[model samples]
Target: MAQECRIPHTVLCPARTPTCQTSPYLEAIRRQLAVRTRRLNDTGALTPGPPTASGQSDDPDTHDGPARPVVQLLLCRYLAEHAVEHLRCVAQTRHRHRCPHPIRALTGPAGTWRLLPTGPRRGQLALPDVLMAIYDLGHLPYRGQLRWRAQRCPQHDAAPGAADLALAEWQPFDPLLHAAHIRTRLPHPEARRPGSR
Candidate 1:
């Protein structure tokens, strides 16, 4: 529909509009599709109220977009916690459970990163901050399932498949989440499921 409508980023999407595919805009539809597809196991969310052990609610039923404001509040809290968890892990110098959401690579390490069609380095600098807004404002409910852990760094290849093997047994930073790294090979949500492939 994006192509038909003269919008960029639609040639690869191939979905028609006015059919209620899932999002009001291209971005949200894409975001929601990604999170739900990768989460191998989901614990869902809890009802929110005051604060809990993490000092936040576990609610997932609210959001501000297609979902109501309450829904956004619940999802935003969870996503914020996820961002905090990521920051802490990276700071401690521990390799995280490779997220396997099959995303476009954000960067290798920033300054030396390459540019791609999706856009420039929007992730490294303000990903965490932007994530907060994505949930709170975008009302994005696809947080836990968006993994992009399939690492392509040539540095890791010296081990020759060792990194992939290690990830299989390594303890998950957040066992509650089925985190997987994004890679080129993973199944894309927009692709039509094969009759047998």
Candidate 2:
């Protein structure tokens, strides 16, 4: 028989707990860790959200375009506290026979990187001081701020690969490049080429 899950009022996720994919507690925390990327997208702080095509490069570094106004918010202590709160709630709902949701106990030293934020912006920095302050706390584990750059993704020719299979690599969505590719491939554009005209 399995032992009863006697979770505490607060689930103590230690610093050493493995990442979300490996640790059950961290996994639960991951589910709750919504970075609010959509909010950033809506404000034009980022080019756009995901759902990239398989053949197209998703790497932000490959894009060669004017930079957009962007900001990054590093969640430090806030992340840990949030995880604790979430675990506490899950613990409260644990079953008598066994926890319906198993929370792997935190062990070892704390990890440095719980979460890292990265995205592009459309224009100048316009965040209010109060809101920035919350993210800029001294005690926080991670640090970030709005930064400007010309190209979100550096342009590069993709190496030939299995055309039918998606590459096993991270890619940044470059809407500009995607649109340009589509524009070039259109049959109407080919018919109006300089030689034909």
What lDDT does candidate 1 reach at residue 41?
Answer: 17
Give lDDT tens digits, candidate 1, residues 1-197: 35555544552233333343434576576666556533421212211134468864343322211111111222121222232112111111124554332221233211111111111132333222111112221221233122222222333322334334223112222212312311111112222122212
User: Where in model 2 is the C-alpha error above 4 Å?
Assistant: 1-21, 48-197
Model 2, residue 62: displacement in angstroms? 13
> Which 10-residue window in model 1 sums to the lowest lDDT?
110-119
Model 2 Cα lDDT, one tens digit per residue, 25-120: 645653443344434433434442242777443433222211121111232212111121022212111122211221211331221211122222
Name the TM-score of candidate 1: 0.15
Each candidate: RMSD: 21.1, 26.3
